[model samples]
Target: MVYLDNAATTPVHPTVVQVIQDALINDFGNPSSTYRIGKSVKHALIQARKQLAELLNVSETDVYFTSGATEANNWAIIAQANKSREFGEGHHIVTTAIEHPSVTNVTKYLETQGFDVTYIQPNEEGEITVQQFLEATTDKTIGWIAMAVNNEVGSILPVQELGEAAYEQKLWFHVDTVQALGHLELDYQALKCTSFVGSAHKFNGPKGIGFLVYRTYQEHNHLEPLLHGGGQEGKMRSGTENVPYILGMVKALELAKKDITSNFEKFEELQAYLLTSLDSIGISYEINGDQKNRVPYINNLWFNGNIASQMLIKMDLDGVYISAGSACSAGSLTESEILKAYYPNQSERWSQSLRISFGYQTTKADIDQFIHTLEKITKGKIDLWHSNK
Candidate 1:
């Protein structure tokens, strides 16, 4: 089947699988143990952290491994509120309306506990401007969290601008870089954000492992540990470190970094082909995000009158896999909250949206097959509509 759901997750790379297997066979020791096996595993975790830090352009001490981006996102934002409650700097947060549920829900949870949150609306282009962010900031705002690239629509946020704005206001900045990692070049030092989170699986690595990178350890705020027991990840995150998965994740990033330029070029070519084919089919589609400014791998389209759920099922049946929206909220009957926030008056248009994402393994042949199947499906539906007319 043609899997176009990279925004959800990706199949682990063969090299990554091999590395994971090696770690399981050779590095089976608990990282917290005082014995040699433990020491060895600890070293492995340390080395993985260092490699990830190097990729993010941050210090090794600032990189903390976690279960996934969801956990990292929760830990970062909630921790900001918790710290503020203790130290009394602020009780407010500013985040875009398009945040992944990981950030959106956590912010909502904080709001229930008396912390105020301002959800900034993005423009029609599915992009949050620097000015909108600056306008939303208040003295009570303790932190601002947003995604580098939107998980559903693929719009790239002005992270550097947001970081600069946050810096000027002395507010903590956290970015959910889950969709942007490996898809874009991210330098935590360059962006100057307080923290950024990335999940490995999005870049052809194994699931259940990710990392959070802080810009600096000095003056850094701590989270109330989500999992307690072993004091792993410097007590920021606690538990036995998943060395095999971590190693695989590191190798996946290594591969992505080495071949990113070529991969991006290939995706752009595929995107152009797909768009051309869509145009040729005479299918009515609205590009959801800023097409010129999005990541090369993602394309969110609103098929004017078609039901996204029906199209997804039909695509799956035709051996072409696409998605209705973010995989995190896929299969839910409700409309996309992100779309609703941006196009509040257009429920029909919003329900018709679908997100097609590419990955390292996507190819021209795959796009051709998908476009052909789509054309046939849409043509049959159009014929039926005219008959009814």
Candidate 2:
């Protein structure tokens, strides 16, 4: 099967799998125990955190492990909102409409809890400018929430500039780096965000393991514990650590960091190959995000007509697994909120775009198979279909 949906999740790397397996078999002791086995396990956890921190260019003390990106996003946004609302800090938030549901849902909940939120819409190219955010910022705005890279269209947000804005205004800024973790080079120090999150599965690591990195930019900057139990993660997040998964995640991160540059160059080649193949087939299509400010891993394509759902089925049947949008909402195959925000008036664009993402394993042969299958499915009606503006 040609799996071009790496933006949803990546296949676990062999090295990471071996690490997790070894941990489960030989390092099974709980980190909390005082025995020698436990002491060694505990040291491993600390080292995992340190290694992950080094990869993201952050301090080890700032990282806290969690279930995944969803939980990390919730903990960061909800905790900050609660702090601002309860402690009289501020009751307003600034975020983008194209953010992952984990963020949008939290902002929606905050609205019901009496905190005002501004959802910034992306421009036609699926890019949000720093000026738009700065203009929306008000004195009552306490925090800013956004993603480093959009999962749907791969649009790279102005996170650095937004971070600078947040820093100058002394506002709490939390970035969801879920899609950016391995694909983009993140200078955590320069980001100036109060916190940012990463999910292991997106980077060829084991699922069910991710981390959150928060900093005390202000004296009151603190996140209340989301879970109550053995008081893990410095008491900010509670639950027994998944040592094997942690090992797998850190190993995956190490591999990604080592190969990021080479992978990027490879992706550039793949993108060119894809575009040329499409043109050779005379298939009418357009990229769905800001061409200049996007990642090469995920490419959202707008085909000629409202045929994404049908194309998804045809591709799946042809053994080329792609999706119309985020896998989280694929059960319903709903319109992409990311595209909606970018082209609010153009329903055709939002409902018809296919998300074709590449991973470390994706190859030129896979692309050839995808294009061939796509050509067969789109045969005869190619003239009837016209790519929307």
Candidate 3:
């Protein structure tokens, strides 16, 4: 099958799989234990942290692993909110309308706790400008959270500028880089944020493992721990670490960094090919966001006279897999909130959207087959697929 849903998750690399298998079979000792085997396991964990730190251009102590980006995001936002309360700052937060549910839901939950959240709406391009964020900020605004790249439309935001603004205002800045980790050239120090969250599954690493990078600028911890136990992860996160998954994530990240340039060029070519082919097929379509600013790996397209859910089901049956929106909101028949925010008046466009993401494993042949299948399916030829189903 041609899997075009890399935005959701990627297939783990064979090398990473092998490393995880080896660790599980040979190094089963707990890193928190004081025995020799445990010490060795602890060393493995340190090495993995160091490797990832180097990849992100940060110190090893700044990286803290978690169950996934969701937990990391929750910890960062909630902890910062708590810190704001302790400092007597009013309950106000700044975020964007196009953020993933990880950030959106947490902010919603904060509202229930009496915090005021300003969701800065994006322009038609699915991007929030720095001015928009500045306008949203108030004296009570204690934190700013946004995503580096939008998970649904792949729109790259002005996160660096926003982070700088937050720093100038002394408001805690947090970025969800789950979609940008493997696809973009990331310099954690350069991002200038209080912290950033990422998931390994988005980069061909194992699931159930991700990290939060906390900038080490001050002596005191600005954020509190969500999980408390043995005081692990510099006393910011607690739990016996998943050593095998950590090792596997490091391996996968190394591979992604090693081949990022080549993979980027490949995806660019594939994107151009797919769009051109779609035009050649004489299909009516409209791109959801600003094509010039989006990452080449993800394409959010709107086909005329087609429903996203119906098209997704047909595409899956035809061996070309894609998604309607974020996997977190998959199977929901309503329009995408991101699209609605982008086009507040044009509500019908949201139902026609499909998110097709590319990966390192995607090839020209795969795109060609996908385009052909999509054309046939969109041409009102559904009897065969329905009969087979």
Candidate 4:
């Protein structure tokens, strides 16, 4: 099967799999136990935490593990709100309309609790600018949270700009780095955000594992723990650690970071090849978001009609896998909220979008097969894909 839905999730690398398998059988003791095996496992967790901290350029104490990006995202928003209450700040939050559902839903729930949230809309680019964030901010606004890179359209948000703005305004900042993990360089210090969340599954690692990095020096650090049990993660996030998955996750991330530059260049080459192939095949498509300001990993496009669901079904049956939008909402056949936020009042555009993402193992052969399959699928209806503009 030719898989192009990497933005949704990636297959685990062989090395990561091996690491997890080994730990599962050999390092089965719980980190919270005081016995010899437990102490050794606990030491491994400590070392893994330190290793990840070095990769992100943060202190080891700041890294806390969770189930995945979803949990981390939920914790970030709620914890930030709780911190706002502690500081006596206004019940207001600043976030983008294109944020992951994990974030958007949390903000929506917060609104029900009397916390006003200003969701800044993207300007036809799937990107939120610092200016928009600043304009949305008020004296009552407690924090700003946004994804470092949009998962659907792959638009790279202005994280550096927002981080600086958050610093200047003394407001908390949380970045969802799920899409940014393997695609973009992760420097917690350089990014200057109060906190950032990551998922291991996004970068060819095991699923059911992720981490959150919150700066200890920041005022937001004083917020109470999001989870309470077993006193794990310094009482900030409680629960016995998934030791094996933690080791595998750290391994996968380190591997990605080790070759980030070369991988980025390779993805650029692949992206250019994909567009050229589409042009050569006479399959005209309008890129769904900012053409030049997106990660090469994801290519979201809007074809002629409301055929995203149909094409996705056909592609899956034919062994060439792709997706309409975010995997969490892909089954619903509903219009993409992300696309709607980018192209307001354009239901046709939102409904006819496809998100094709690339992984580290993706190759020119995969792209060739995808273009060939797409051409075969749209043969008689080729003119429909041939846009005037």
Candidate 5:
């Protein structure tokens, strides 16, 4: 099968799998225990934290493990909001319209709790500029949450610039880097965000394991804990850590860091080849998102007058796997919020969109097969629509 839905989740690397399996069998002791077996597990956890810290160029203490990006995001946003309340700061939050549901939904929930939220909309290119975020900010704005790269369209936002601006304003800045962790160059010092979230599954690691990079400071002392039990994760997140998955995630991160440059080059070549092949087929389509600034792995296309669900179903039948939008909202027949944010007035294009993403396992042969299959499916759909018209 030609799998092009890597943005949703990637196949775990063999090395990562082996690491997890070995840990599960040999290091079953709890990191919180005081025994020798537990000491070994604790060592593994520390090493994992060190490796992830090195990968993102951050201190080991800053990396806090969580169930996934969703929890990390919720923790960051809600904790900041709580801190604002405790410190008598503003109750307003600044975020973008194109944020993943994790951020958007949490911010919406905050609104019900007497907090104000400003969702800055993106331009036609599916990009929220630094200026847009700056303009949205106010004295009442307590924090800002924006994604480093859009999950559906791969649009790279001005995260570093926006984070710097947030720092200047003394507002907490949180970035969801789930899509950017493995695909983009991550410099924790340069981004300057108060915190960032990432998932292991997005980067060829085990699922249900992710990390939050929280920059600790005296001002953030009032941040509330989400899960309170064992007082783990620097007392910010409380739970018995999943040592095996953490080890697996660290191995996957190491591999991704080691081969990021080569993988990026390969994805770039594949993206170019796929676009050229689509052009050769004379297909009527428009590329969604900012083509110039987007990541090489993800390509969102709008095929004229085509229903994304139908295309996705047909492609699945033909052994070509792709997605209509975020995997979290895949089965929904309605227009995607990401596309709607880009073209608010032009609603017709929303249903016509599909997201094709690449990964380390993707190949030129896979692209060629995908293009051929897509050309056939799109042509047939166009013919059927025209005949009905």
Candidate 6:
């Protein structure tokens, strides 16, 4: 199948798989052990952390490893909330409505625990303006949470500018950079964020391994351990380190860092091909997010009168695969919150929205084939709508 669901997850690279296999076989000793084998494993773990730090352009001391992006996001939010509670300083958290389930759900959980959460809505183009974000901040607001790049619509948020605003307000800023890590060049020194989260799988790395980057070691930003045990990852995360997965993640990130430029060029070619074919089909479509600020790899399309799910099925039958909106809300197949945020009171029109994403494995031919199938589905849907009328 011509898979277009890179946003959901990606297949692990062969080189990464090989590294993982090697680690599991030869470096199975516990990193905490004092034996020789343990010493070697410990060294490997440190190297992995340093490699990840290099990729993020942060100090190894500031980087903490987690199971995945969800866990990292949870830890960041809860830690900041706990700190706020302790000081009675800033009990309010500011986030956007277009955030992923990981960020949104964590914020919702915080609300239940007596923390005030302000959910800011994005503009019509799925972008949160710096002014709006600043307006949301108040004296009680402790943290500003937003994504560097939206996972569903792929719109690039002005993270540097937003983070600066949060800093100017003396508030902690945390951004979910899971989707943006490898696709976008992140200059950690320039971002000026209090914290950031990224997943390895999004960059063709191994699953179950991710990292959190924080600016300083201030106790207010200090996170209470989410998992309690042998105290891995600076006592912030517990349980034994997944050394094999960590090593593989390092390899994948290095690969992405080396190849980002060419990969972006390839995505541009695919986008051009897709838009050209869609235009040729005479399909009336609108881009869901701000094209000028969107990542090159994703295009959220709104076909005027066709149901996205039905169109997805048609494309699947023709050996193409795509997602509706958020993969985290899999099987629900409901109207997307991101769409609703942009076009309020237009729930009926959401069924026509489709999220098409590409990845390292994607090609021009794949876009051509998918577009051909889309045309057939669009024409058939139009005829059916007219018939019912």
Model 5 regions more than 4 Å off: 124-126, 217-222, 330-333, 381-389
RMSDs, each prediction? 3.2, 3.6, 1.7, 3.6, 3.1, 3.3
Candidate 6 lDDT tens digits, 1-389: 78888888888889999999999999999999999999999999999888888777788988888888999899887887788678877689888888999999999999899989988887755568888877877878887898888888888888999878877887788989999878788787778788888888988988788988866536556767788989888887889999999999889989888889999888888888888888877778888876678987888888877788777767766777898898877467888888888778677657888888888999878787777777667657423232211
Candidate 2 wrongly placed segments (more than 4 Å): 380-389
Candidate 4 runs further than 4 Å off: 124-126, 216-221, 380-389
Give the whole-model CA lDDT for all candidates, comma-separated.
0.82, 0.87, 0.86, 0.85, 0.86, 0.83
Sorted by lDDT (best first), the order is 2, 3, 5, 4, 6, 1
How well does candidate 5 match the true structure in TM-score terms?
0.95
TM-score of candidate 1 against the unseen true structure: 0.94
TM-score of 2: 0.96
Colliding residue pairs in candidate 4? none
What does candidate 4's lDDT look like per residue over 214-244, in tens digits? 7743645464688788788998788789999
Each prediction's number of clashing residue pairs: 0, 0, 0, 0, 0, 0
Residue-level lDDT for 201 in candidate 5: 99
CA lDDT of 287 in candidate 3? 84
Query: Which digits, one per residue and each the tens of the lDDT, describe model 2 over residues 56-172?
Result: 888999899999988999888888778877778779999999899888988998899898999999865567888888899987889988899999988999899999988898889
Residue-level lDDT tens digits of model 5 in 163-267: 888888888899999998887886877887888999999999999999888885445545567778889987878889999999999889889989999999999
Query: Which 10 consecutive residues of model 6 have the lowest summed lDDT?
Result: 380-389
Report the Cα lDDT for residue 90, model 6: 67
**What TM-score do all the candidates reach, one by one?**
0.94, 0.96, 0.96, 0.95, 0.95, 0.94
Candidate 6 clashes between residue pairs 3 or more apart in a chain or in different chains: none
Q: Give the TM-score of candidate 6.
A: 0.94
- Comparing 2 and 4 on TM-score, the stronger one: 2
